[model samples]
Target: MAKFTDHDDYIAAAPEQFRPLLGQLRSRLAEVLPDADELIVYDMPGFGFGKSIIAGYAAFSKQCGLYVSNAAITAHADEIVAAGLKFTKTGLTFSPRHPIPDELVTKLALASRRELGV
Candidate 1:
């Protein structure tokens, strides 16, 4: 595997099946927070605004995830669950074969930005 020195590298180095999923998630996040900085943080592709993480995404062997804070998930658990995606304390997971909803992505990203007040 290639070393990931940055967000785009991390996405490009993901499994071929996961690349599109990661790209879609990245694009959605960018749409919501165009000023956020893209970074490879803690081994995942993430966005930051003034040192606060706005959003992130990663590819696992069987799933891809959109990562926000635990605070964001706690505040919006019902809405996230209603979207039929599985979210842990820190992020939401979905199969690469199934594209996650763009609206839900935008909503969650905006909520995260609000949480950070950035």
Candidate 2:
């Protein structure tokens, strides 16, 4: 596995099966936060707002994740859980095979950006 320095590098280094899904996720975030800086934070593809990390995503063997804090996603808790996805204090987890809802991803990323007051 290659070290990733940017969002594109992170997505490119992900498992081939997950690349497309991760791309969709990254696109959604970019749509919401066009001004945010894309970088690797906590070893994942993340967006930075000023000095704070607004959001991030990662792929694993069994699942893919859209990373946002609990406070950032609280507004969508019910909908996230209703979708049969898992939302912990850290972020949301969904099956890589089952693509994450684009609208939700946009909303959460925007929420995270808002939380940063950026």
**Candidate that would win on TM-score:** 2
Q: What are the lDDT figures for the candidates, one per model?
A: 0.80, 0.80
Q: What is the lDDT of candidate 1?
A: 0.80
With candidate 1 superimposed using the best TM-score fit, by how many Å does residue 29's alpha carbon deviate from the native? 0.7
Candidate 2 residue-wise lDDT, 1-118, digit = tens: 5578787788777878888888888877887888888877667778876547788888998788888866777988987877778878769887764666888887788787777777
Off by over 4 Å in 2: none
Which whole-number lDDT from 0 to 100 does residue 16 have in model 1?
85
Model 2 scores worst on lDDT over the 10 consecutive residues at: 94-103
Each candidate: RMSD to true structure? 1.8, 1.6
Q: Report the lDDT of model 2 for residue 98.
A: 63
Clashing pairs in 2: none
